[model samples]
Target: MARLAYVIKFVADMDRAVAFYSETFGFPVRMRTPFWSEVDAGETTLALHPASDANPAGSCQLGFNLDDLRAFYEKGAVTFSVPPREQHGTLLARMIDCEGAEVSLSG
Candidate 1:
């Protein structure tokens, strides 16, 4: 069976975002630097990247099963919830980067 091992991400500030996810989610840092950081999510890898100042974020929701559900949205990620007819969930949010990379965070 084939498995999706990693999902590479792009962000504005590596240090800030890395610290935020690490402190908030408690996902250990697998590999990191100024350009990218790999988050160890046990079953999956959440790779973080820094986005530029000018760019529309892409369409891609990174669904994460987290312990601290509320804190995940506290990092200024936009909340998105369908009108009951779309999906069943109490929490949903999105974070867009300058390069048009979008991450939909759910609890």
Candidate 2:
């Protein structure tokens, strides 16, 4: 299997996006640079890279499967899920990340 690495996002405003994700989702900033910033969410990382373009939809979503989906599902908030079903011992959902990139949540 091809192990998941990092998902890169193009962001015009890094500070605001970073603050939004950190304050909203509790993801920690793992690294930052002049052109990019990386945030850690569990074992996976999300990259917010500087982009000159204004539109950011063409970006792809990256997912990391969980061993315990119930914890996430049972959370008091965050009710958004894709397809809204469980199959093959996994649940799936898509969420917007710090940089407004689509993120796949599966377990």
Candidate 3:
């Protein structure tokens, strides 16, 4: 079986993107620089890359398996994009990130 490691996201500002993820989820930073950064999300890593003419913003949606979706959602500095719902025997909600990307959290 293949193991999942990282999910890279292209954003407009690397600093802002890194700050957002760090603050929103409180994920520890594994590595960080001006052009690139990565967050340690337990079993997987969330990577952030600088957006350029080739890499547009809001490129894709990133999903996270969390324990308390509602609490994390409410406490975080994020705008709710999709309200919480029950599906697949879990609670899920989608929120907009600093760079307009959709991040789904499920518990």
lDDT of 3 by residue, 1-107 (tens): 12344576888888888889999999988889987789988887888887766558856446677666777777766798787899768787777878876676667
- TM-score to native of every candidate shown: 0.47, 0.48, 0.52
Candidate 3 wrong stretches, greater than 4 Å: 60-107
Collision count for each candidate, in order: 12, 0, 0
Candidate achieving higher TM-score, 1 or 2? 2
Answer with 1 or 3, whichever has the higher TM-score: 3
Q: Which ten residues in a row have the lowest lDDT in candidate 2?
A: 76-85
Q: Which tens-of-lDDT digit does each residue in 1-107 have in candidate 1?
A: 22444565667777877887788999998878887688897787887766654422332235444454466545445443431122354554445546555544445
Error of 2 at 37 (Å): 0.5
The candidate that achieves the highest lDDT relative to the unseen native structure: 3
Residue-by-residue lDDT tens digits, candidate 2, 1-107: 22455566667678876777677899998877767778887766787776654436334357656565556657634535353367656676555556665666666
The TM-score, computed over Cα atoms with residue i paired to residue i, of candidate 3 is 0.52
